[model samples]
Target: GPYVIPSETPRGEKYLSRIKLSWSTMATTASCPPPSVLLPIRTTTAGARLTSSHGSRAGHAVTTTGGAAHARPPLPMGMARALLPQRAPLLRRLLMAGALAASCTCFLLVLQAQASVPPRYDGFAYGVGAAAWKDAVLVEAFLDPLCPDSRDAWHPLRLAVERYSPMVSLIVHPFPLPYHTYSYHACRALHIANKLNSSSTYPLLELFFKNQGKFSNRATSSISSTAVTGEISKMAAQAVGNSVSEFQSGFSDMRSDMAARVSFKYGCTRGVAGAPFFFVNGFLQPGGGSPIDFSTWTSILEPLVAHHGQTIEMLTSV
Candidate 1:
């Protein structure tokens, strides 16, 4: 079966496309040595005849009467011989061509192998020692801070991360849904907290998820965006143990807004359509938008952790 490489990013897709074009060009032009090198004629008693020992014309004969070589029907190799002075260059070209083709084939096979494996997660790590363990399963949670479903998933997801300990790493991406009026502000607040104190990120996320009702669209219907952000900054500052004034200052910093926007844009690239989305080892898990339980997460992660452990053990033994 043909291996289909999952597209991780637009840049990666462009890189793969360029490699494909190079492969195609190599296939068409370098598949065989030049005809001048492979089809040198030998003067025989019968006539001037050229014999091919490689490529499409392998084991065939060509006869020349005048100055031009003419193709003949397929015949036996009785007349084929090493009767040309260009034999050394011919072998050299054949070897060079063979080596080139083999290299391209090996490169493609390596790419196919990589395509079969799930991509490793590369994002901001959450929680203590979340990314400390080598070969840990990566669990990415894309959540809108004010989304009800995200709140519901928080507990079980936290429990799963704790249960797995160093064997699993969780990265929380703040994906603010457009419909949620204050979701973007909430996410920006979380990012501000992260910048203030790296360890405070998850705590602030938990705080937002727990008190999401206070910042819901209905609750803040009459409030201006500035008022909502001010309220969120208070909560973020308290959660991260920073001064409210300092956190509010961060809110005004364009970098915090840019960070939040980058997070949202990354979610879009990952095809996140709603809150509480997930990716296990970079493969999107369908139906992850709904809240998942601790038991369900365990069921999905146990075998994966065990397999990873076994792989490590095998590699060490070897």
Candidate 2:
């Protein structure tokens, strides 16, 4: 049988979407009752009674009385009036129960969508490390070039890298914090420098961290973004041993901003809210958001190295 739409009757209305009904041959027998033709209905806002005008087939219009609009469409009500009286009562109960279950399911789906975390980082670049090493674990570090805590973490991290080369690698993500006005410029500088010389990116970061005081003061001294960019461009040229003009072209390219933005977005998905955030093996390190002591980092790395069949002394000697 064809799907039934809502029909405005004295009792109420019933609406169904894409429904298929199985009609028995007995339905046409004299003992059976007539099939109710469910037609689409529209209600009025004036609290007027439902007034329907249409046949059982499609292409028919059902209008409300008094020409008023529907405030809310109600759920499908009791079974069609033409059904056997005994069957109508049980069928209506089942329809109401199903509607309630569907409502609950929809609510759960919405909550699940809201609670989901955003996508995380999966690509390479913006770090000083081999893209992949079977023996090595990948660490992502989020840093704001002008933050003091970031500087504090840099030393231990670099020493760790030297000691754990093929066994551990760090991917630096420049997440210039909002409060550090000049930090974003510094991050952009690192991005530009990386393009000029991949090896020079970390060195450039080191330079910025060492002289954060100067950068912070300059940032607060009412200098324009262009002026700061020019200053950074010159520094980048010196760091990468490239001609100033050559460095300027790469620094000014739109890709510099693109690189910074990609890194920032990746960090956000991983829950990086501030500078000096660290993730080892894609898991956030305990107390990684704060300035961790050198010994603490060594404690964290020693077991990882040992687990990978490499001792600290062996890697340090290498």
Candidate 3:
């Protein structure tokens, strides 16, 4: 069977000639329909529209007047598939490879972003010359002022810091636990005390730890936050030898709240999940989130102190 041209006009003749020439060139190297099957191709001022003629509604293929071709449509499912070139396999493979590469790049970027050390805040350090010793071992304790576990751990921690003296530095970070309703207020009071007198920081913290039961959820359930804050301010003022009015003024100050918020956020960056969590030399100490005995503290500090001394001696010799 011979192919039939659809029209007798000059434009139709031109289209027929182009189709015959394209069919002849493509038949040798590309898969296409037999000579009797007609492929519907229309040319407009905008572009050329190509459609599969053999009852296949798979998709359309568009080409610009300048001969630049866009993405080709998928072929028909069964016998009509041969009417177009078989390019799906290669295109699918390329798309899959691109997606896999993108996924791997994203995964690596996430890992790189997550790989970092927590930052240090020197202002929270306690005791004389705490932040002065550059080579000393750093002991960062993230504690909740009203947490029972934090109260239990404070004694041993204080003793350990005192025993190490200038060889170890201890920084107390206030991480108020949500379940403890008044922990934020207590921590805010401690920050205020710290600003009034750095020496009063530890004393005020010790007092809060001792009287935590008074500010517990059960005890303060019936009282307003203002009453609790006033009581805390009075205790802090007494402990720090400051007037109650001065302490109350600082308690209501926004700077104290900002300081407490900064400390809590710093703890979060270090992945502090509970009160009394500890980090030695920027590394989290296992089993430190609980109440560890003085002996346990000694066991951990002895080696670190010895190492510190050795490093100092070596640097001095150098």
Q: Which lDDT values do the candidates have, in the order given? A: 0.75, 0.67, 0.78
Query: Predicted candidate 3: what Cα RMSD to the true structure?
Result: 13.2
Top candidate on TM-score is 3
After TM-score superposition, the amount by which residue 228's alpha carbon in candidate 3 deviates from its true location, in angstroms, is 0.7
Worst lDDT 10-window in candidate 2: 14-23
Q: For residues 165-230, could you state the per-residue lDDT of candidate 1 as single tens digits?
A: 678888888999989888888888877887789888888888888898899889999999888878
Query: How good is model 3 by TM-score?
Result: 0.63
| Cα error of candidate 2 at position 141, Å | 1.0
Task: Give the Cα error of residue 303 in candidate 3, in Å.
Answer: 1.2
Arrange candidates by TM-score, descending: 3, 1, 2
- True lDDT of residue 299, candidate 3: 97
Q: After superposition on all CA atoms, what RMSD does each candidate show versus the true structure?
A: 20.9, 16.6, 13.2
Q: What is the TM-score of each candidate against the true structure?
A: 0.61, 0.57, 0.63
User: In model 1, which regions exceed 4 Å deviation?
Assistant: 1-123
Q: Per-residue lDDT for 234 in model 3?
A: 84
Clashes of each: 0, 0, 0
